[model samples]
Target: MYEWSETDLMIREAVRGFIDKEIRPNLDALESGEMPPYPIIRTLFAEFGIDTMAADGVEKMLATQRARESGTDSGGAGSGSGSGGGLEGQDSLMAVVISELSGACMGLVSALGVSIGLGATTIMSRGTLAQKERWLPGIVTMEKVAAWAITEPDSGSDAFGGMRTYVRRDGDDYILNGRKTFITNGPHADVLIVYAKLDEGAAAGADGADAVPARRDRKVLTFVLEKGMDGLTQSAPFKKMGLHSSPTGELFFDDVRLGRDRLLGETEEHRGGDGRESAKSSFTAERIGVATMALGIIEECHRLCVDYSRERTLWGQEIGRFQLIQLKLAKMEVARMNVRNMVFNSIERARAGKPLSLAEASAMKLYSSEAATDVAMDAVQLFGGNGYMAEYRVEQLARDAKSLMIYAGSNEIQVTHIAKGLLGR
Candidate 1:
């Protein structure tokens, strides 16, 4: 039942205009990895006045928190609303920005999403007021980039349980040692949210060395690391299958000494929960985000294919006359409609403060991602030789769509989560 309001359409048109002038002209440079997304993202924030708005929002949220701490908080003044103290009643606007940018260059959207949605959002939800003040201002304003590091080489699916990256308690500090891979913005992030297992060492184990807990059983702790910290190495961007503009890479922490201040919440046990619980709480939102991205991909491919079908001719008639081509177009339209509806439903739920459960989010991710990938591939087939070439752009969309299937917990993992939700396990 939800639809884009007049204001939402106006913002979408503005975003599309920006994309035409800024993103499409540099698509080659962006897709080739010759250009990083940060500069363009920063420019976007400044052009849209997002920087000033984010700064004001953070100041207000922080003021509200301070007032609450001092027991002088009024019910309304300076109070932050909406999920995670973000702009209230602006979820649709945010979604429009994300989807529009995604349609033009998904890589840019990926970089922006991970930096704010996962990285800054985590700190906002879990970090102390001091931590939020120190990091949120720069991050929300796009002055600094942030990365959320959780995936590891051996622990692709089992992020926490199989995590090898760990920190051992030191004298009022923690010695961190481990490596993380496939980290978005890892190569250039100014701030990082790193998750590690808490290794208390053999001394704390019961019955000496025999009682030491297995590595998988250790407590998970979260920390914030800066760009140039000692013993920390951020690798050059990896050559990826798609999303070259996003700059995925690896991070190695070798005896990286972290003070208690670097630990999120400045405590091992956060008031909300431990690091594992904190990380799990983000899964639903992140998966729901995949639907929005998928919707973008689907819409772009559908638009391009429809235009192509009308123009291209064979047997002295337009290709749109062919049933086979029409089938592809029809299927693409179906996908676009379904994904758009899912995104709209999510926006409405967010506005109502009734978020979807993890299982529901997973279902959206699975269906929308598959639909996008299918639609993109079909677009490629419809274009025939043109689609195979990079110049046609369908190849890029296909590659980008494929990455959606693998990224954000993978379709295989989504199936398991959906089952768990259904069985109530």
Candidate 2:
């Protein structure tokens, strides 16, 4: 049984209060493909300092301690050890805050997820002191928004295997060339964490360049690609089945030149070498971020369905009274609890400075994403005709839920990851 501290409770209440006051009323406006007023997001950040809470002075103390032991600083807040203590308590708080904020609106939550988890994580975990000094402050302060560019036109699940994007070293610059598809926040991101092959031959030689590698190989490298860089172009937003407000689009990099500093990790010593170790590390963090986002969306779907069932009625009784409806609700509850527990447990392990096996992360992502899809579909069924119509929120839930299965390493890809992790190469 996971216990919540007073601080955790307070954070949850505060975030939920802000959501109730600021976001819920504006749901209609946001749902119509209109951006949620920036002032609202700004107000929450200003009043609560949401972005920095997980990185602030006290939080930093804890994170540093945890990072020292874990050899990686991946958990957001309270994962660190400090004089203040209560690391586990802090993890619960962070989760509650994320869940509440996400429950209000997934677009906002996803934006934060990418910006904080991926955007800041790249610099925090891999950047040099200078790079951290330059990027971390902005990300921590919410001054810059970050997006990840890994999924290419034909490289959804097979991203690393078929990654055609190439970065060629040219003295002090690396020229990047490629196209990324289905990029979340592509239209508005200020920074991009891109993965590309620095040397295709090295990658292939290391056995990390194929979807079904012959060995336990690693070679792909990642970079912190910034916006407005030369050769970085964004396309008009693509029409999507869901998350219309999230603004998915394409990123084109043609002869994009970046300073050597943009290269994330050890480059000189590992030149012409497989970046398998680095790639595995990065993927581990990314999988956690993806799982958290999926969990948030699924929780929301469950909440909405439960709310609808209780309120809507037929034949003088709540529709929830029906046996079939009750069964659907029951299954949703069980799935929701299962996925939530998995996510929270994973976060705890991460906070405790424990190594999370790739199989565990992949399994969690696969289960939660599929759970979200199933719950959303059931929600649509519960809403009957209303669920199919955009007028009702269930349809939107269903739409956004599908993307969960497709993105962040599709469920199919996750299955492969799990199998690989379990099969010993």
Candidate 3:
């Protein structure tokens, strides 16, 4: 029963038009690693006025916060509709953009989400007004690319417990040392959000002096670093199975020095558990938004499958007559329906002042991601030999869809989170 308003429909059309005009023609170059995604993304921002939209949205949020501080709202806590009205619409518009672009290139949306959703969001939420003013404008406008680095060589699933990076206080600055791998946008990110454990300067340190403080009791701290900082080395992009448009790489910080201002929030309060909580909350948003990407993948795969089934004749009859081909088409339709409903439901709930809990977000991610992977594979199967070839698009989609289950915490981890939340409740 969920449906887009007329305004939402127009937005979808605009996004699709841009993707067709600027993206599909260049898919070969993008996929072959001959071109980077940032330039295309910047062009999209300009052509669609996404920069202006983002700026207006930011100002609206600030105005609402000011009113809250001044007690100018006669209606009270939930009185001003600005927060609910503007925010919900933004979320919907975001979903539309993600879904449409995903249909064309998953890598584009993946890169976009990390910079704006993860990078800008972290500073905006945890940083002070000064920090936000200094860093946010460039990122929000796509003028500068950003990367969020939390996953280390040792920390993939158990991000907190498995983290090996550590930051220690050194006179008026902090010394950071660690190696982080599989960082999105790392190779060329103008801004980097790095997470490491705070060192208490205890006797036990690295280099066999003691053991690098194996306490495992330290707090996780987040710091913002620029690309050319001293002792900070960024590796070249890694060859990946898919998402060629997105350049993934490694980061190395060898005694990189940082000041208090670099620490998010410019305070020590971020340690202990506040920083961890903030990252987890960001994960929930990221996970919930996965539904939109999955929905797009499902719709695209189903569309291709349905069309193929009708035109692809076998044994002197259309494959659509074959029950086997028909089954795949049916299942794809079901997945498309289920995912679309979840997406619209989330939008409606947000508009009504209801935000999903962590467990709910995990559930959506789990189901939607699996569905996307399934649908993409089925589309490949429906195409038989053609589906497996790069010319068919579904081949790329299959690889891209697989990443959904792995990133943002694997689907396996999501199950445990959902269970823990249920048991706690």
Candidate 4:
């Protein structure tokens, strides 16, 4: 029953205006991977005062963290250390922006979401004060792009267990060697959050390091890497099935030397959690975000299909009069309503300070992503020959909707999380 407030509606209109002015004209170049999405994203930020707002918010959060670290204000709730509460009041606004952009250019939304939601949020929730001061300001403001690298060539869904990327202690620093593939914004990211296992075998001579865990069983650690660091090579963006504007690529680290300062939280026993826990902590948000993106895809497909059904006439009658076409439209409407309700319910829960559990988020992700994909494919079918062609844009949406099932942990992985949640695992 939750609905967008008047303010939310006003902002949505303004966002739509911005998209029409800024993104629509550049759709070809953006979709062709001919133009990176960052410049337009920055333009959107500046045009809407998002950059200013983000900068102010980050500054305030950092100041609060500083005060708490120095024992000045021991009374407040947040020191910018908790994982769940960075952007408390802006959830609805962010939902509006994400959904709007997703409908027009899902690639753009993916790039932005990985950078801010995964990259900056992870750092903010887990990094030390010095670490935050060093890396966060530019990222939150969209001045610098960030890539969160956890996926690898070998570990499609096994994540930590199959992780081959690893680090070893070297004096007070760590030497990292690994390759990360299918990384969003990896080609041009200014900052990178890399997760690697600690190779205790390399430190067998040290106390308590004699018993090295199996490679797959090693402790996972997170580190921050800057672009152009020693022995670091970022690959060119890959030719992808869809979402070309996001700049997906690979990262190769050949004995990349990382100072202790780069280690998140600067301790293996970070108060926030270890790398596995940190990454898992992001699953709920990431999954819910997939639902948001899915909703947009569903809504866009529903809108296009409805419009097309009314406009295209055959046998001296409108296609809308055909029973088969009507079925498609009805199904699209059902999907839109169901997905929108789920999104609204999530928003209401968030506003009430009751976020969904991982299992619930996973369920939302699974259903919404599948729904979006189904609706998009149906839109293509409803469009007939026009749907297969790129000119109509429905094909592009179909391709984009398919990705929602693959990333943020695949739909297959979502099932396991959902099962775990139900069984109280």
Give each model's clash number. Answer: 0, 6, 1, 0
What C-alpha lDDT does candidate 3 achieve relative to the native structure? 0.84
Point out where model 2 deviates above 4 Å: 36-40, 52-90, 199-219, 266-276
Please provide TM-scores, in order, for all candidate models, with all chains considered together: 0.96, 0.83, 0.92, 0.96
What is candidate 4's lDDT per residue for 284-366, written digit by digit as tens? 88989999999889888988888998899999999999999999999989988998888888899988989999899999999
Estimate, for each residue in 91-132, the C-alpha lDDT of model 1 and write its tens digit. Answer: 888889988887889999899888888888888888888888
Judge candidate 4 at residue 406 and give its lDDT. 94
Candidate 4 is scored at a TM of 0.96
- Candidate 3, position 277, lDDT: 81
Superposed model 4: Cα runs more than 4 Å off: 82-86, 202-213
lDDT of 3 by residue, 337-382 (tens): 9999999988888778787888989999999999999999999999
Q: lDDT rank, highest first?
A: 4, 1, 3, 2
**Total clashes in model 2, counting residue pairs 3 or more apart in sequence or in different chains:** 6
Residue runs of model 1 more than 4 Å from their true location after superposition: 75-85, 203-213
lDDT of 1 at 76: 72
Candidate 2 lDDT tens digits, 84-193:
11122345665676667655666776676666666666556555545665666566556777777778887666667667777777877777888888887787777888
Give the Å error, residue 96, model 4. Answer: 0.8
Distance from true position, residue 329, model 2, in Å? 1.5
Question: Once all C-alphas are superposed, what RMSD does model 2 give against the true structure?
Answer: 5.7
Error of 3 at 172 (Å): 2.6
Which candidate number has the best lDDT? Answer: 4
